[model samples]
Target chain A: MRGPDAHGRFGPFGGRYVPETLMNALIDLEQAFRQCIDDQSFQEDLHTLLEEYAGRPTSLHEASRLSDALGGARIWLKREDLLHTGAHKINNALGQGLLARRMGKRAIIAETGAGQHGVASATVAALLGLTCHVYMGEEDMRRQQLNVFRMQLLGAHVVPVTSGTRTLKDAGNEALRQWVAQVEHTAYMLGSAVGPHPYPMIVRAFQRIIGKETRQQFLARCNTLPDVLVACVGGGSNAIGFFDAFVDDASVQLIGVEAAGSGLDTDAHAATVSKGTPGVFQGSLSLVLQDRHGQVLPAHSISAGLDYPGIGPEHAYLHHINRAQYVAVTDDEAMHAVEVLARHEGIIAALETAHAVAYVLKCAPRMPRDAHIVLCVSGRGDKDVSTMMAYKEAHA
Target chain B: MNALHTTFAALRKQGTVACIPFVTVGDPDLEVTRALLPALAAAGAHVIELGVPYSDPLADGPVIQRATARALAHGTTIGDVLQLAQDTRIDGLDVPLVLFSYINPIMQYGINALIADAARSGISGLIVPDLPYEEAQDVRATARDHGIALIPLVAPTSHARIASIVAHADGFVYCVSSLGVTGERASFASEGFALIETVASLTDVPVCVGFGISAPEHVAQFSRCCDGIIVGSALVRTIEQHSEALLDRSRRVQATRDVAHFLRTLFSQSSGGAQ
Candidate 1:
């Protein structure tokens, strides 16, 4: 991938696009980030927290039956799903929330769609003794009521946003507005590798530990980088974590799978990277699905997490630099992969991760024997079972 | 003459009763922005504050927040406002264009880049609400280098801070009429007149009171104390509420002319000392 500057500009994609009210906060964050990343005390603190508080070093398990079924490549799953909050989101949230406490911020605001990020933020807020406010789209609040209740139980005020398209985008917009107003005493804990400038860069730095550990583990086991790295793309946090370490490795191919509900030819899909054009949205230049008049179009997918009109700006830069390739997997294919993995390995994966599994299944068969591939098992499927059951009932 | 200085000089010559109107660029549409500016100029607006739409406008109340959202939804940017200023110049409008924005957009568009663009676009001045005097020196210097004025604000709360602000202020002192965000209040605070007098006593430059000076009576009161009265939220609220009617050609012209007539009445009455 092209080198992003300290200001988070990756080939004209990422930069600060927020209001002036947040400038001081951004400057403070930038300084804190530079100091904390290299400080030994900060590293030791984070290490202790990860080990004792967050349950770090999750297993890298080989799926033997799935590997045999796939016919050519050996597949291993890095199980981030088994983390405390059932996803990789907790890692970055816990890190940032701790830093917010260090900065003496009394409140935290976060935006979530499928509620994973909100739950993680709530978890950190409760642990750190800070008041937390989470903005979720009205539609997502109805769809992901369980996670919403989970956040409320953790003492976070779950605000339902009804503006714009009433989805993740609106929640993000509202969260930004709130941050701009209360930047003095509040910290906006962004969920993914998106948003303007320092957020995208800082968040990636926090999540890079995932790739660092996985790289060491893989090297110890197999003696080299895998031939291919696969991960699903929502706002592409998991994919970025898995891909960042190998960006300069020409021998390793990085592939990001997007949710293609039904088909790309159909209007019902969230294949933004696969079928999108570059435009400015949510404080960065990225691939967004828009009409002829430049009005952003609402994206659709069975996985609520992947149903966004734009990908992260860094992913857009990666695509532009040809360091990564993005492809779309249909809902039917992802669901089939979910069942196949469950029946074969007794592991039910989140639908977002199943998109990556489906791509691996499609591409693995054509690869040479002895090709090694690592897939990011991003989240547990407990939250998605109801949607999966409904899809099964309709199709059966 | 520099646009901001020219505006202040005009207000001083016109008996300390200048009328300043504010509008968000691309609120209803870009075309409305194009039409309303020249109309405000023709209708006795000595200085015009063109607001650049930001995603989060913390200091604005609901009316301007809604207007900002509308403008952002249309994909408005700082570049769009600069282009609008340039287009207005092509139409032969020579009024002082004071860009009223928060500092984030300018920083995002780089300080030097914005200053150069403002100069090329024929913009005369800038007012950044959140940019206090301490952080404003660099931007003010850049503006000065380009021959544009950086009009700094002096709030009532900033009592001891007024000297430094006035010393650095180039165009005029934007004396915030109240402590709160921009909106219309039922009555002008007696403290507002006091603050205006304090700022006027300290600065040789003209003082314009803003941020809740909406009604004719407020204008008259401000005219008695300050050099100019800037009416923002009230005028923005009227345009936002009447934007649909403005789609009709006759209604658009008539509505603008009606507002102009109202402003003229306020200016004349304020000058006449007939509250």
Candidate 2:
């Protein structure tokens, strides 16, 4: 939504909190990034990689049956789940991996929560022939064991971080530690539009491709942009991916749905933007669940991907600037949306993406009958099927 | 003015380059480090880069990493280091005391709180190796408000980026001897001297060479080209290997004195004069 000037401050949210040893390296990276991203050759190379390798320009499908089932609003889904790696994360991972190659870095490091980003990064690393290391929390490693196996199969090293709470936050912290130590020859491909300065900026730049494509596709389909745009927010990558292109267009309503777990009133939620206060965590200023003494609070959610205690810094900026509306969807509603999509469309969506589906379902009845809405089907339900089945059985 | 400024001025008056020794505080024990600082300053060290222990020190070599592990195991912290400086009154010992560290521990300590505590403890400067100069605005501003210098570093590859780094650096510029992490090497390469000259040409601030500077010849070579010589891994190695000799209360004070004396002698001899 906003660009960082020469200083890396996005309304005082995105300043660099890196160590001094890596200052020169960061400066070198900044300079190289400025020149390379602008060069036509670099752009062409990135486009070629996206098209030939990762399959660019994923389709936007209109869900007529699902819309008829709702009987309130017209619904369309931008099928990022159809993309390679079954999510929108490959776009950012490829961009960062290419940038690393251009910077002469031999290795890439990344952190994963639900392991979608890890799989995406590992895929890119395998294709690019760069050494890749993905740090995952011990708890996440256990929960997302399939993705962990997939990453390993792709020839990437998966290190399970056990410190802190042994979750996404701890994985991110461990990755940061590893990056600081080896900043000279290594590049940390942060998974989301989060972290400090250039990361939020860079990750968003990579993810903006999704929004760019969505704008053109939506315009082509409806002869205008959708009335409302919705996406799920874990670290807010997919939400920001679609929202970035629409921020300046005030007429296009951007709604970001966060996982509310059991309920927002309960501790079992990841509704940071809706319920938390502003603070610095993982090198960026954002709304985080913290105690009065500023200690980070434990976060919870039915979906492992949406279990983070904080949203991305750029999301915080967007919320502050009133450019986007952030809402929360409870666990029950999300499960219902999963079943609705599966029964109506024969497409089971990831639990994280179900949050967006749930939000639209809840809001659709209140909107005009002919209102057009676009929801980002951010990932597939295949990886999350086991968890979804368990939740359904428990509820039954 | 901060003690760092005073120390530089004093060194200039004596026509001598500053000898800054870096050591992880409480490497062997907190009590031993509490007794080591004053002895180091009294021996001839113009400035002290007192390292605060971090769990993961990526840029550090084997020697410093072991030292950090030891210090952290001993429960060394930013507050503990600051308390040592305050309790021993070593911060008032004329030599500038710069807190050397990675950023996470400092961020965990709270940037504002660390600056305030450091100022109260009479810390003269901060040298955060992991904090880039471009990102040091808030840290530099806080240090300046408290009259402490926020010294930034420049690596060998810091050619085109010199102007920005020079603009941000205070007290002095720490010129890394090589591209890799801190550790001992058999010989100092010509590239280190070239880097020293390059850094010196970019800024008027004193250029102190460190990283891989372990032996007398390395110090001698730096003495001929730069304004200061910093020995980290070598001293860390000495402490690690000779802990009993260095930590014995009767010999602990003398160990730092001997190292500082050795560094000063190497510098003076290389300059073809006596200090």
Best by lDDT: 1
Among these predicted structures, which one has the highest TM-score? Answer: 1
Judged by DockQ cut-offs, is candidate 2 incorrect, acceptable, medium or high? incorrect
Deviation in Å, model 1, residue B67 alpha carbon: 3.8
Q: Give the docking tier of candidate 1.
A: incorrect
Q: Tens digit of lDDT per residue, candidate 2, span A51-109?
A: 88777888889898988877877898998998789888998998889899998888999
What digit string (tens of lDDT, one per residue) describes model 2 on residues B1-275? 77777777767677676778788998898887766677666656778889887654556765786787688666677788888878767345656788886765566678899899999987888888767776677798998898888887777666777678887778888887766677887886677788778877877777788887766666666777777778788877766765786778777766766655655554555443224
DockQ for all candidate structures vs. native: 0.13, 0.18
Please tell me the TM-score of chain A for candidate 1: 0.97
lDDT of 2 at B39: 64
Q: What is residue B126's positional error in candidate 1, in angstroms?
A: 7.9
lDDT of 1 by residue, B170-210 (tens): 88888877655677877876767888888888878888888
- Worst 10-residue lDDT window for candidate 2 chain A reads A17-26
lDDT per prediction?
0.82, 0.80
Q: Any runs in candidate 1 off by more than 4 Å, and if so which?
A: A1-4, A260-280, A284-298, A389-396, B1-5, B12-19, B25-39, B42-44, B49-65, B68-94, B97-234, B244-275
